[model samples]
Structures are given as C-alpha cells and as structure tokens.
Target: MASVALSGKVAVVTGSGGGIGRAVAIAMAEAGASVVINDVGASLHGEGASGSPANETKALIEATGGRAAINTDSVAEWDGAQKIVQCALDNFSRIDIVVNNAGILRDSIFHKMDPNDWRAVIDVHLHGTFNVSRAAAEHFRRQESGAYVHMTSGSGLAGMVGQANYSAAKLGITALSKVIALDMGRYNVRSNCIAPIAWSRMTSSIPEDSPEKKALVEKLKRMTPDKNAPLAVYLASDAARHVNAQIFGVRLHEIYLMGQSRMLRSVHRSEGWTPESIAEHAMPALQGSFMSVQSSSQLIPWDPI
Candidate 1:
C-alpha cells in the first residue's frame, strides 16, 4: 500500500495558532514536514492580537519532536504575507505547501450590514488569502512544486442567513483558488479549497440550547479537526499531485466532492427574439431547472454532518 507522508517537505499554515489551522499545521508536522505556524492571534472578529497562539502551537509541535516555527504576521497585508513566506525559506530552506486558513466573521443581514463590517471580513478572508498566495507564488515557482489548501465555508457555497460579509468573502476564496490552480498548474503547483464543518472558536456562536446546535455538537464529537486534517494533508502530498482546481467539504463522517456553477438549461432562436418571445420560450424551457431560493439552513435542516 502507498503511504501519504510529507517527509523533507516544508509547509506554512496561516492562522494556525488554533482551531482548524492549528490542527492542520500539527498534522503537517506529524507527517514529517517542517512547519511555519503563522497566526496573528486575532479575536474571532479580527480584533487585537497576541503572540501566544502561534507560540503555543509551535510549542505543541516541538513537544512532539517536530520541527516548527512561529510567525505573528498578519496575512491581510502584502508585506506581512511576504515575511511569513520568507520565514519558511529562512528556517526550513524551502517551501512546499501553504494552507490559507486565516479568517474572521462579521455576520449581518445584508440590508442592515455595515459597510465597515463588509470591508473587514473581505480584507481578512478574501484579500488575506490572496496576499499569502501571492507571497508564496514566486518561491513555489522557483522550486517547481507547491500545493495550496484554501479554507472556504458553507456560508459561501450554500448560503446562510446573517453572514453576508462572511459568505461573500468565502465564496470569493473558492473562485480565487480555482484561478490559482489554473495559472500555476503548468508549473506543478496545485490549489484546492475545502469547506469544513467543525466545532471550533468560529463555530462557538451557535445558540447553546437550540436543537440544531445540540445535534451539531453531537456530530462534531466524531468529526473533529483532527479528522479534517487528513484531507488537507493528502492534498499537500505528492499522492494527490493531479488533484487540482477542485472544491471539497469535510463533514462528520463524509467527504464531499462539491459541484460548481454551470448552465443548467438554455434556449436558442434562429433569429433574435423580442423580450416577450424569450420570456415565453426561455422561461418555459428552464422552469424545470429553476431552483428554490432556500438558505443553507433550509436545505440541510440538520446538524453539521
């Protein structure tokens, strides 16, 4: 049987101080990869920073006899991201994999959402992912092989209430990952996105007494961050070299291969028809394919699994 190992590889994982990021960074190290643990130690809303998160994560890896380093740079800024990438080169000598898992949430109904709320989430998730990826591109190109594991969310893919900013940013990341895969595929660099459902600081907001929350909590007992790390580790390894430009989801006991957007139905006319004719012809043809405007909650109506 073929084994999945990252021996001799160097990886940088953003926002790895805790939660999914921490799990991923540690997993990479356990796979024999040297790791750069990057985390600014920001609160869930992206406010304030401390070095404890990154330092603690690094210590955890070191305790397990794995080579690791801590970085407190924010990925939201171009220079900060550059410094993070450079940290890997300076410490590990080369870069092989990057996991962009840094993010924050600012939920609000779209109409009532504040402009600042929208911008802040976009800056951290969308722009942050771009910044880190850009910083690593040059090094990855020089090395001729690299892999990116970008974190997305159900809020973006399936749509959720009160997550206007978060959803938009996460969805943007999905698109961005695909483009990076396309642009860097020829150079043997691959990129893929994951929408993870886990119990973490990010998910602590669920109402404690709700049935949905209880079920989700029960589901998470089995689908821990530890369990979610394998898929990311696989994506970063040579075994999945050909798996690029894809979207996946990790739920309790299942791994989902998600679908992308495409034309479900279409109608054509020999000659350009008036709006009236098209409305009648196109609407009739596409009626069967029309999807209901239900939010993520309505569609799943269950726990994380």
Candidate 2:
C-alpha cells in the first residue's frame, strides 16, 4: 500500500504546545502538512499562560524542515478561536484539517464541585471545541473539503468517579462532533472524535513511581504508550476522508473503535393492560433495562451499516 501524505495541506491543532497535541502537530507536519500550533500555556486546571510552549513546538517543526506557526490563543473565547483559524488562513491560505485537542480538568464529585469548576471545564472542553471547529467548518464549507478530529476522553464516554465536570464536557464533545459530521457531510467535511489515554503532564500527577501508582500507570500505558501520534496523524490526513461521525480510543498499541449511543432499547408491551396492570408489569422490565444499560464505549468503533 502507498503511504498516506498530507502535502500542500494545512492543519490546525489546538492545545498543540505539548502532549498529544504536540505529537499530532509534529506528525502532521512530518507528513507534509503545514501546521498551526495553538496553546494558552495554561496549567492542567486551566490557569496561567505563556508563549514558550507554542514557540518551542514551532521551532521543532522548523528544525525538521516542516512549515508551522504558533498561535497563543485560548480556545475559550470566540475571538481567540477565530484568530487561531485566521492565523492558518493568513499564513497557509487554506486549512485542510483541524484537531480540537484543547482541554482542562476540574475533577470533583458532582455535589462537592463548585458551579465555577463546572462552568470552567465546560467552557474549555465543550465550548472550546465548538469555537474552533465552528470557525474551521466555515472555511471548510467554502472549500468543500476538510477533516476534524475532536479530543474526547474515557471519562466522558464512561463516567469517572471524581470527574463529573470533565466527563460531562468530554461527552458533550462527542455529541458535538456527531452533529458536525451530520451537518458537514454535504460539504465533504469529515468530523470524528478520539478518546485518548496517554501519559502527559495532565495525567503525570498520578504518582507513577510507587507500586500503587505504578499499577495504575501500567494499566494506562497498555492503552497507549507515550508516542501515540501516528493514529492521530492518520485521522487528520486525507487517508481518513471517508471516516466521519466516529469515535476512536487510541492507546499504546491498541485501537478500539466505538459504537453509537444507545438512545433506545428493545421493549415488551403487554396487551389490554390498564394503568395499574401496566405499572406492576412494566416496572420490573423498565428497572432491569435501565440498570443493565451500558454507556457507549468510545465513538470510533462503529462502521455505518
């Protein structure tokens, strides 16, 4: 098979200063696509900002003889999102791909979590994806072709214990990507999501040095090693043009495609049942159905039949 290449294409990767975003940006550039690196240099909690990370990534791309530019735009605001896309347009003339990888974590059990924490995570993860993807989708519609990769999470797909806020935002991203895929299909724009598990500064806080931490880290490592950029790069390339409205879980050496949300399920109805008769009979089935329900795993596995 011939190798996939992205020559003459331009890609914008939000949160590209470090971690998966950085890796994806570098990989896309390596595959011959011009890249725009955007990051706010915020901490895991989404605080603070600096220009160093974006600049450093840009330098790395340049050193590798790849074209790139750095944009220190926060994905939280509409203007920032517009500016990030505009940077690509100003420099590269056209945008062929977008990786909406910007995110922040504000983990707290729902009752204990503050409104501010919930809003902050939602603004960054859900609204952030919307901002950037919306901007890029406009340009994509004009050009009649584009690719979008959203950074979702396992927490979002399968809720985590302490990540109520983050999980909600991440899941919302999956929903957004699906809607975009449906809306943009006519424009030849492909939209998908990735539930990635990798070790980065965001996840490094879970002590990997000790035995307890070591086990957890080891489990995570099995999902995706440090270098998990190849899949991301492929998704952002022309090779994945036909893949849309999908969610994938990318880890060390394993790729698990996900299925669609189970919005409805099989039901059995009894004949000639009054309200009381129906209540007694249907209650058990309803409860069983509800209790046995499993959330959709990742968004990447289902092939449209």
Candidate 3:
C-alpha cells in the first residue's frame, strides 16, 4: 500500500489552524494531496480572527515538502464558503476532498442557553457544514469524484448535559451527511461522518466540577487529535471508494462502525385501543430495547485502548 493514498488530489480542511483540524490538514498533505488550510482564525468560542495560525499550519506543511495554501473565509457564510472552494481551484486546479472540521463550543444548560449562543453554534457547525459541502457539490458532480468527511461528535450522537446547541448541530451534521450521500451518490461523490474522541481545546473546555468528570478528562488526554487523522485520510482516499453514508467512531486504536437508526424490534396491533392499552402493550415490548440516558464516557467507560 502507498502512503500517498491521495496523490494527485486536492483537499480543503476547514479550521486547519490547530487541534484536530490542524492534525487532519497535515495528514491530508502527507498523503500527497494539495491541501487548502481553511481557517477563519476564530477562537474556540467563535470570536476574533487572525492569519498567523493558518500561516503556521501552511508553513508546517511546506516544511515537510507538502503542498498547501491558506484560505481565511468563514465557512458559516454562503459567499465565503464559495471563496474557500474557489481557493482550492485557484491553487491546485481542482478539489477532490473536503473535511468539514470547523466548529466552536457554545455550551449551556438547555434553559440557560441564550438564543444567541444557539444561533452562533448552529451557524458554524450546521450551516457551516452545509455551506461548504454545498459549494463543493457542484465541482464534485461535474468531476464525478469527491469525498466529504464531516466532523460529528459523541456529545450529539450520545448525549451531554450542557451542550444543547452543540449537540443539535453535531447530530444535524450526521443527518446532513446522510442526505448528501443519498443525493450525490449518482455523481460518484461520497459523504460520511466521523464521531471522533480526542483531547483537544474543545474537550478542554469541559468543566471538571465532579470527580467522575475530572477522571474522564484525564483519560481523554491519552487520546490525541492525530489518532483521528488517519481515519479522515483513509476515508478521503481512493482505498475507501466503496464506503458511503457511514458513521465511524475513533478512540485511540479502536475504530467502530457506529450503528445508524435501525429498528431493533417492532410490534403491531390488529386494532388500536386507548392510551391505557398502549401503556400495557407497547411499554413492555419497547422497554427491553430502550437505551440508557448515558453520556459518551459513561457508555465507553474503560480507558481507551
């Protein structure tokens, strides 16, 4: 197998200034792709912008004999996203991969969540993912070849306490990836989601108010952002040509094929009765399949392998 799995390809990795986004951007370049390091240089809270971080990433790639260009447009905006895509075309002549890894943390308990926070997070995560993906869809369709690797989260797929806004946006990205896969399959364009568990600034923002929360954060420190990079690179490569619309979870060396919405079991009634009858009949049948309201750490309890 060749280490250059993405040779002759061009990839645009959003939020490639640091953390997981930076890691994935470097990995894409190392795999022989001309990369577009797209970052608005916003902080973890989605405020402020600077070009130094993006320039730093570009310098790192160029230092290793890899090709990369800087793109500072905001993924959350329509015209800005098109410009991001256009940057790739202008720099590398074409694009073959798009990694939607740009996001921000605006966590708040449901009732306490400000509408402003909700809109900001959604604008960057949900609408941002959609805008960039939609902009690239045209080129992908015309070329009849492309791959999309979206960054989803365990917070959304499983559950979290203070991130109503973030959770909704991440889960929405998964659904968006699925729909994009369905809509663009005929064009030979693939879309998929990666729910990665890694220690980054995003995870660092978690409050350690409890012993259990503190312990979980300590364990997460062992899972570096680079662990998720190889998976993104593989999914973007020709080697994963047959994979589509799938959700993958990466924890250290473990790679899981996460399950999608599927019916475990179903029951039917000849004639429906009152609500009291539904409690008697449906409750027992469904209770066995009910999943616990557990956080991602609670579900994956042991230290990552």
Best by lDDT: 3
Point out the higher-scoring one by lDDT: 1 or 2.
1
Better of 1 and 3 by lDDT: 3
Check candidate 3 and list the clashing pairs: none
Model 3 agreement with the true structure over 32-129: per-residue lDDT tens digits: 99999999888899999999999999999999999999999999999999999999999999999999999999888899999999999999999999
Residue 27, candidate 3: alpha-carbon lDDT: 92
C-alpha RMSD for every candidate? 1.7, 4.3, 1.2
lDDT string, candidate 1, 10-105, tens digits: 999999999999999999999999999999999999899999999889999999999998889988899999999999999988999999999888
Candidate 2's residue-wise lDDT over 37-87, tens digit each?
999998989889998999888999999899998898889999999999999
Sorted by TM-score, highest first, which candidate order results? 3, 1, 2
The lDDT per prediction is 0.89, 0.84, 0.93
Residue 76 lDDT (model 1): 84
Q: How far is candidate 3 from the true structure (C-alpha RMSD, Å)?
A: 1.2
Top candidate on TM-score is 3
- Please give the range of 10 consecutive residues that has the lowest summed lDDT in model 1: 296-305
Name the runs in model 1 displaced over 4 angstroms: 217-222, 301-305
The true-versus-predicted C-alpha distance at residue 133 of model 2, in Å, is: 0.6
Sort by lDDT, top down from the best: 3, 1, 2
